[model samples]
Target chain A: METRDALLEAGAALLREQPVGAVLTQVKAQPVAQRAGRTIGAFYHHWSSQEAYHRDLLAYVLDPQRLLSTAAAADTVLADLPRGLPLEEVVRRAARRNFEIVRANPYVPLILALWGKQAQDERVRELLRAHYRSVTDRLVPVYRTLFDAYGLTMRPPYTVEMFAATLTALVEGLTVRAAVEPEVVPLDLPHAGDLSAAPGAGAAGAAPWDLFSATVVGILRAMTMPADPA
Target chain B: METRDALLEAGAALLREQPVGAVLTQVKAQPVAQRAGRTIGAFYHHWSSQEAYHRDLLAYVLDPQRLLSTAAAADTVLADLPRGLPLEEVVRRAARRNFEIVRANPYVPLILALWGKQAQDERVRELLRAHYRSVTDRLVPVYRTLFDAYGLTMRPPYTVEMFAATLTALVEGLTVRAAVEPEVVPLDLPHAGDLSAAPGAGAAGAAPWDLFSATVVGILRAMTMPADPA
Candidate 1:
């Protein structure tokens, strides 16, 4: 890899472990240089200041490849499931897989931290827009596939994009809540209703219908209808 | 008001205007003391350090009265509607009022900023938990009122608390997204479907159905069912 790529990858690896608010100050040139197997001179040779380096680093982290990997993993979970699963099952599997994927990804906190940073940094704001655009692009197809398999279509006035955006926001929002109040947003509670029954009609049984999954199932059912057999 | 109350309120007012991430360092002793019209010694008399003052500030802002006010406003929007409105209308009105209330509030940024700060500050985390509890307490009654008016009830496994939490997260998450990318998460668009029609049946016309409202409508519809007339 090129020196720039090496530095960014190293910086991201370092950032993965650090908490969100205090990331930029920790991005020292010498340490990043050492991690990249380059010198301080090389760091400045590429970027003039820490601000400039941080900008490039934001762009680097927002790379579509890194951003879409988690989505892709979630998609695989859905795809691997057997055909003809009930609507509730489909949503539950997707939500649980998504929760697990997001929880496990170290970059999630860093990315969430940047949500506030965008207010002060226009460049960071621009990078985030691009990141979200890519995220939406990747997610739209996944929704399309899921809806297709489930024999559903976007409710009128609601596009796949709308569904995708809501799901994204819910996952991010719940993750923030869960971090602070784990008891409130448990990842998997005993399924509140019968495992075989549809939502809004759960009987006492065991399944993974926590807040995240329950909400996702609700959104999915609300935003879709059976495809017309025209 | 007491000196401490005055100081905390002044700090909160100041924080309301600033953007989210760069909040803490801006919480200096001198300015807060000046704004509160007290001596810097008074600031020290109340709190030994800036960090201590900020902790108090978080607690002050998290006061249930201030936090629940927005929820109250949204509830009023629902209550003001005529009896027996369609479910979509109810959800849309509630969602639009919430979007407006949240968009207009000055303290949203500061509150959102605390989300990322929770990782490092145990007290902030505790304060947030308390704030959420109060928010849920306020919202449950609102949901019950809406559901009662509509003759709906929580689906077997879904409770009022889950709905309230999801709605709160959606607003916060979308606000963060809107701050960075307003175009994607618009507040109001020309209603895509007919004013009289339910969702999944939009004709190019006028109404308020943006991403936030649309998502809320979906969640509401999915999470509730018709009450049996026993």
Candidate 2:
């Protein structure tokens, strides 16, 4: 159990700091006597194989309790947030922090190794799906909070879940993007309140942070307000 | 040049049908006799290797013209969208259309591939950054039309361009999600106007499309109007 826990801890560490590809390489390079290999060996001994170890590793990463707890913290802090900071601002701060967590546990891409190529194992698919559903479930509340706070009525069944899924997808995408292309990130993408078409050309005198803050506020306002031509 | 074009055309088609990893296997299976290998021969003869071929393939996929054209068309529709439907309703319709376009193209994932692994080549990184810039440019006008129509008073400097980039990022995220995890994709993730967070029960009774349209109207009404805290 200790060895297994050590393996999980090590993997989680590597997933956060480097790509999964690099993680596998680093693990293989360990001395024949190091605990890293034994850690994996223990996981396989208990779980069946390295592939199974990853399945459970991902499941652990997608644990809803951990995710929701972080969100709960964010929710608590929202009460203390400046009155007019806006939901987009809230999401951005939350999003960056959340993605940092994801970066550290970059098990998402490796899950594909088991889920995509190992489709023969129905159990793997079920495990992966369950993890995904947990993610979707955990995110729904974040969207629900934003919509409700803004006085937006979430459409039933899919409203909170849908927006939740969109954010999940975006976060997942960003994780993948960071893994693959770290350069073209939030700094480059449009903010929710982008009022102009010019990239990075906030107001003539507005500093970058101010421009970004305003953009966030603006998007929440736009989404909140009436967009009808009338 | 013609052979290069032919290889690229063939490669894109193959990429659309199968995963990037599967491409080489499928290509190699093709009559090497015709391709020394025919188009393969032609491709390698002009280009250094498959990696080079792929690099160009990515360049082609990120070409701003195509992305901008899509943005322009979306803008025309959004700008001239009827007022009868609530603003959220209109955005949802647009989001659905955007998903269909991405679903239709397999090479879209290549956009991420280029983004993830091209920093070694300064030219590739610049091209990708440029592509990111171009897409944002095209999306700004759409935000402007909506923000102006909706009468949202966003602070200056963080204008339509930022919104466009943000929206594009969301769309890109959706495409990647659908490719890797279709089953988990929230049915409503691609549909934007369904921002309502109503309870999950009794959702089946309502026509989701209609409910979504109404809900966006509701959200917009809510966002624009002051929260009564009633």
Candidate 3:
């Protein structure tokens, strides 16, 4: 690997463990160099100062393509699902997938730390803005595909933009809930079509729904109507 | 006010100005005492140590009553609106009120700071958990009232708990969006029921909807149906 790539990769690994407040303090020259199997001379060869290094590190961390890969992967997974699945089942799978992706993501804690820095740093805020826009861009197509696949269109006064933003925010918000109050937002969501645990759901049985899927399905049902055939 | 109250209030004021990473460093005994107009001895008399003081501060800062007051007020405002307004209008008002309340709230920044501390501090996590519970508890009744007042009930496969949690998360998520990407999540949401700016909305004209209210109103409409009279 190139010297800069090795050093940055090492720095990224170091940052993954640091607390929100210690992001800067954790990224020192010697340790990152040692971890990268590079020298201090190599570090300075690529960057002029710690500030410059930190700026590049932030960019590397917040790069839209890197940050949004999981979400993109989700779209591919959902699109490839069996064609006959019920819409609610499809939404359930999507929500559960979303919850799992966020829970398993290694970058979440670090991304959150960067979010904390946004209030004090203009550059961080700009990077975050670009990141959110890309997020919206990525989600818009996923939502559009679901609507098209199901022959649905948005209800009056609600647009694809609003739908995308809401889903993104809902996921972001629930992830925070999961972190601090796991009971409130359970991690083990029932499979999309499972209903055996639902109370009084009858002999076929209804699986008790979770907050994430329940909300997503509800939004999907409420926001769309059958597309016009004419 | 009592010396403890005085000190805590002062400390809160001080902490509000500090960035998320600097929360701990900003809360010093001398400065807090000076701000509270109390002697250093008085500060010690109230608290055994800085750690003890910080514990109390976290509790004070996370107090459900103070944090939830704005949400509770939104409920009162919604309930007090004229009895005969259209449901969409009513929902629009509620969404707009929620957006305004969160945008104008003084404690939001500090609360977010504390949230950043949760990964490292068990106490902060516990406090946040308690805070989220109180938030849910507080929101449940407000949602119930909205449902009852409108003679609406949740549609099949949905429940009040999911609604409350989604709304709370949506607000929290959108608030973060507003902070980082204000344009995408537009703070200047149109007034509820005003459709003057809506594209091709015709003679009555429709106002351009914002991300927050559109998602909210969509959820409200999607998740609810007319109550059965039987």
Per-candidate DockQ values are 0.15, 0.07, 0.14
The fnat scores of all predictions, in order, read 0.26, 0.08, 0.24
- After superposition, the stretches of candidate 3 with alpha carbons farther than 4 Å from their true spots are A1-26, A34-48, A81-84, A186-209, B1-22, B37-45, B72-74, B186-209
**Distance (Å) between predicted and true CA of A104, model 2?**
6.2
Best by TM-score: 1
Off by over 4 Å in 1: A1-23, A30-42, A81-84, A189-206, B1-23, B34-42, B74-78, B81-84, B186-206
Top of the candidates by DockQ: 1
lDDT of each: 0.63, 0.43, 0.61
Q: Indicate the residue-level lDDT of A161 in model 2.
A: 50
Docking class of 1: incorrect
Chain A TM-scores of all predicted models: 0.77, 0.54, 0.76
The iRMS of the candidates, in order, is: 16.0, 17.1, 16.1
Angstrom error at residue B141, model 1: 1.4
Ranking by DockQ: 1, 3, 2
Candidate 1 lDDT over residue span B66-179, tens digit each: 654457545665676565556566667667777767764545655555665566667778888888888777778878888888788887566787778888888877876777
